[model samples]
Target chain A: MAKENKTNINRRQFLKSTAIAAASMAAIGAGVTYIQKYKRDENNAQELLRPPGAIDEDAFLYACIKCGLCVQICPVHAIKFAGINEDLAYGTPYINAREQACDFSCDSIQCAETCPTAALYFIQFKEAGLKAIEAVQQQGPEALKNINPFEVQVVAMKKVTHIGVAKLNEKTCLAVKGKGFSGTPRGENFNGVLRPQSIKNQDGSKIRKAYPLKEQKYEREICDLCVTECPIGEEAITLKKTTNPDGSVSYKPNVLEGCTGCGVCEMICPTEPASIVIEAGKTYEEVYS
Target chain B: MSLFSKKREPLPPKKNDEMPHSKLGMPYKEWMGMNEDRHKWRNRRWAFLVFINLLFVISFALDLSLLEGSLSGSRLLGFYLLDPYNSFQLLAISIKTEYLPYLTMNFVIGFFTIVIFYSIMGGRSFCSWVCPYHFLAEWAEKLHDYLVKKKKIKEHSFQRGLRYVFWAGFILLAFFTQRLVFETLNPVGILSRAMIYGPGLILLWVLVIIAFEIVYSKRFWCRYVCPIGATWSIIGNISPVAVKFELDKCGHCRKCQDVCLVPHELWFVTRGKATNEKHYVGSDCTRCGYCVDVCPGDALNFTVKGLDKIL
Candidate 1:
């Protein structure tokens, strides 16, 4: 009886050990299978011919560090970051110039210049070739074909609208307070103010004197923050020429397209409180219009 | 004469007393017997794991076409399998000058897959089972072992710290130059590009590493210099899955430590002790489970941490 019990115990132990070994082996086998599947898929995918214009497919695959500089600096904002698409090649980086084509004419090669990873090469304006122009023309027709030109859709137009113009209140105007058109010596507290009709240039290059006239000439140039501070390349507020009654030409301010509705111009206006304001309006029309 | 009668004539009942304890340390037989059952379990796990890895390699090769410019059905399958949108552009930038937008989806997916897998199993699954780089490195190390007589290299704490510094420098360089210098040097990239563009100096450099692996050590490059490995390691921390060691059950045999390709410093970290003055192990681990297979104690097991647990 004792011998039989001992034999039975040994057999049970052996079977249990074998079972454990088999189980572990199976688990490891499954894991290895998964890895093999993943590698095979990855390898097979790598062999396909890259899309047209792909330079070094392998380097680009590893080198691209996703930074949004190209998208930010694109003049037409044509570049957009790609999202996950399983059917497509590994979603790394690609240009979609169908919407807003690459405007190579922009002064700064900001996209390439600002890219944190030389994922984008910086090409000089001349070197960028005819592709830049072709891209723009292609985009123009494509964009127009998609929708109504005057429609107020977000995708169709730049999203800034002019609100209002800067106004100088005479009572608070620096020139009315005897503080000169340029305001304080430090130029910090420059309320919109006109200079006295006759004043000496700060430098002694021209000799002149101030005269207290009965009526002040409102100098349009006194407050140029709106014209100078706009983020758009061409300032939103631009100086336009107008003929006066005396047959002399004078300059007046005009707002141009491409304003981003970022109120830097209004914020920087040199009034006690800002004189320039972006009031809500339709199509950025004039206050009287 | 009858069999029973003969035995009776010689019979003095045999003494059945237990043997007295000898003070010359525990007997080897008893010590080994006590651990034999546990060791069997471990050895079995190890063998099974290796077999699985072999299967995976076979499957991958069967499915993928490594040849260049071959428009096989597998190539189409590869395209559908690995989305190449951004990867194509990145490769272009690496070879020539071109501007393309950077997209994060692929990186995020690759990162998340490793993290998710690590959380489900222990770290070794990735190294032993999934990572192609680990396989390459291991093959290299095996060659090294064969040629150099299986000598071990001692990894100091400072060497681990240097990896972090190297990764930081890579990031800074990319920030300044807007180029992935590290990726340019990556062996995988070199191989793939060479296959596509034909062999060049870059391919020659990668070939040297392969030679080194065959003769010197397995995974020498991955342990020492892979930036992608470093990236995965940092991300792997949040992985809820890890190998849990039962210290009480461990026999102090150090078998698990021996098979581990990652530095031993990591095991020290997993045990809740700081190794090399760092709180966490450096990111060289691919979580391959070789260590679990070699353990004699059956001390290691995979476990999940709660959501509140810090990765």
Candidate 2:
């Protein structure tokens, strides 16, 4: 009878400890699940513009360690780490194009090159650059005179760099409204900077340097900042002119396949809410399909 | 309800303070002032933490490329230095082959380099000596102690074992979500990134945690949670280097326990508790050497596995 009593107590003790263990494990599992769901929901609410050469969004999240190597290497200080409220994207490098778009001033896509984890994979850009050199070399001296191999390489690199696609809101566009813009695009107090396209120095050598947007002035009969300020030039964006029924020609900025969605157009837009915006993680096909 | 309903109180004093001196005639408070005045190891540890974090800032600001990344991953003189915990999280999420190439050779080498380094030096040394967040948390702990001493707030604690649960939970979380979920809210990575890349909105979250530590709990993040520390503790288990406790030299004053960051590791420091004359401090000790500095009788000191026998 005593032995039976001892066995009963042992079983009860075992059951109690096991129940406690199971309860704690369940609580932890539930907490982690809740956090995952909350983070995913928060992340889904908005999309972020990743640095140039960033892999697919889902893979980028898994691979990036949030080391900030890309952030440190960016010469323009364009790449910034996402804040906590960014949900699953927190600590990841992103470009807030409105504050300061990636001007590609480094010409090397230095941020992507320096990425320790290849979260901003650079192989495609490298391949693009190599292919440009090969195409120029294949055409021999004739192409060499017309095309500076370096310029071709830079353009080739830019061609493959797609962080997002730029979308135009014709309803809010100053160009579509047939209004002229004078003075700075973003106003006198704006701190955003951009490197003007290749300018010749005194010795006839081209030099590119970034200048604060507030210091530069523009006089456009019809606002063309989206078209003019585009880093990828006419291939990416162009001013489309159409003849009206009244025989008057009106112009609208057209976004084309060559657009890298680098967000410079969005930054320089004079509209309250940018008339042209980068649809992050989007392709030209998806936007137009 | 029971967890929240418990009455808040300052932790009771550890042991009675009847005798100022131990049987060996070594005094407690004397060592306190002396150690504080010439705390060489503590000063060196502080300098190391400051230097490492500053290197990241300098490398970026000057374009030196000396130490080019945050604690999550970095390049030290062009050699990869990836954090093992971050690598594990990466592996957990990358079970599918589509993103398999992301785990390049550089990352694998970096990961093993850290693991090998920690296995030799003892793992938690990184927490005390290198981690930027650990440095901040240590200061916060000092402020917490002061607040508790003044009765401004009560010290609340949870089971230290909870950290292990969190460590496992994080990896499991990655497996389930196919994302490095912990990286989103990891305070260690956030603090490091903030130091190098400037402040982010998530710094507010880190501030909330520090405030909670100061007012509600004492070293809550480092003690009860922190999967990073939990990861280190596992690596620290087979470490050859550790704090060696000399049983006979112990005074039973409990000053060492009071000063220890993780006191449970010093359990055998009590009189008549230890089976051996010399016992290595447990893997969770962090090798901070606070107990060594506070020990009036010189009971605990750092030792390497076979080095002591030869010397």
Candidate 3:
């Protein structure tokens, strides 16, 4: 009986040992197959180059935690999430503002300021978008006017696009004939005026109401908000001198790049009816053809 | 067949003149043995790992300093990484201009180098001798063993399945979050942050978890949680180094299994039977050699699997 029991134990031990060896072999085989099939392919090289406007592609890619702060704070909604190919290069947090160009006139460097990581540096006023505008302005108005507003010709107009509209209420028209207020009021004279134009409201209503005297008093002289803030360069609203056939000079307003869809002009318009109101659409007109 | 024949033949009397002496001072064999003993205690492997960790910490600090401009060298390194002008020489060669390449490369290289080195020498040497995180886990396990004094809770098959399910869920979370959550749970990271950030509520909570692990479980982090360990285990299966057992010498005492921190219960499952169990050591083994020391029959031994066959 003891001999039989000992033989049974020996057989059991052999079977157990064989089973363990087989399982280990299977596990090793599986591991080998996984490594062979799933190892990272290092040959793909398309995403290596630094994207446009990135100061340092390598630094930004490594440091960016992909918090999406820049995307949230963009006032113009100019910045957009990068696509897969771009993501591979930029790692998770990357922005492309080409679709909607940046407006240099905004008061805040919202994107840079809100970036949790220093992926985008907090540039000073002179170093940020404002500097790009100043540089172009220094080159003379003719040079500025000659620029292709739609093309990101200047850095200031990085991703600008028409996002809204500016409409006026005819009832609020203070300068129309037979209105309560006509022409520029006292102390309201045009000087460094970049653009002057008839404005419309968001619903395409013409404002005909009497323009508030106090507001108009400042609007004529310092109201470069529309022209300066327009993402496009040709000054969406321009002041023009209408010459009569008899050589008489009369002042009139004109819309050049229609109105850069950005509603900055509407936001800053001072009038109650908002001489300019931004609505969703491509309001900027084609300048090239 | 006579076991006492060798002993019976040794009839020489002790001669003080015949005793070998070292000219310097101590006997050569005694001195050499003493030195070897000291080296064994010092454990050069552990020291190497600590040195690597320190190097990494120093490099990280230097990178931070570069941004402040307090250190020119660091600033230069930053510039090299973050070329603001988009006109760096290194950028020309790199496939991706993004900084992510550098970070990913660092992790991949570190992991593979250690794995390859340990696999060549013995199974999972990094875990046993060098990993800072493993050291922390081991310490915690000791504390847990001392405080809890609990018997092994035999895990049900269903409970074992739950671990894999949780692991899958965590992997999905990591994919979506784009953050290695397992890495975040690393005790090393916890300890480092606690030391640096200090006295915060979160740090306190982490400490509580550590205390709990110290009291209730043996290698709680390693057995169930550590994704790095999971990854290593998967990779280590193909490792050529392993422990072997001599079938003739094993006494079936089960002493080796008792000493093993990892539940060797599954070993039987793999082996197909309980009694015939062989030492199926591979990459999963941390090369701690605890089993080898605990084996009463002296049957267990470390061997280079593929190389021994080749020789």
Give the count of colliding residue pairs in each prediction. Answer: 42, 1, 39
- Comparing to the true complex, what docking class would candidate 1 get? incorrect
Model 1: per-residue Cα lDDT over A1-289, one tens digit each: 9999987887776565445544543453344334424543564422122211223433444454433334433434334433322211222334331122222223334444443334343333223333444445567777656644323221122222222223334354332333323333214332222212133357733222212222223233344434543434364556455667999655434555554333444433445454434432123444325
lDDT (0-100) at residue A89 of candidate 2?
50
After superposition of all CA atoms, the RMSD between model 2 and the true structure is 7.3
By descending lDDT, how would the candidates be arranged? 2, 3, 1
Q: What is the descending DockQ order?
A: 2, 3, 1
Clashing residue pairs in candidate 2 are A84-B202
> lDDT at A63 for candidate 3?
42
TM-score of each: 0.37, 0.81, 0.38
* Tens digit per residue, CA lDDT, model 2, A1-289: 9999987887776565445544654565566456645766665424458899888776776778888778877877888776755544567788888888988888989888877677889888989999999988999888789888888899899889998888889999998989989888888888889886423468886548888988778888999888877778899999999999999988899999999989898888888888888888787998888
Stretches of candidate 1 exceeding 4 Å from the true structure? A1-289, B1-125, B146-158, B191-203, B213-219, B266-284, B306-311
How well is each residue in B96-204 modelled by candidate 3, as lDDT tens digits? 3343333333223333454565446554565666456576666676656655455444221112222333344444433333333332234544443333222233345
Output the lDDT of residue B32, model 3. 29
Top candidate, metric TM-score? 2
Tens-digit lDDT track of model 2 for B41-157 = 677778888998899889987888799889888989888888888788777766753566655678778888888888888848889988887888888999999999999889886
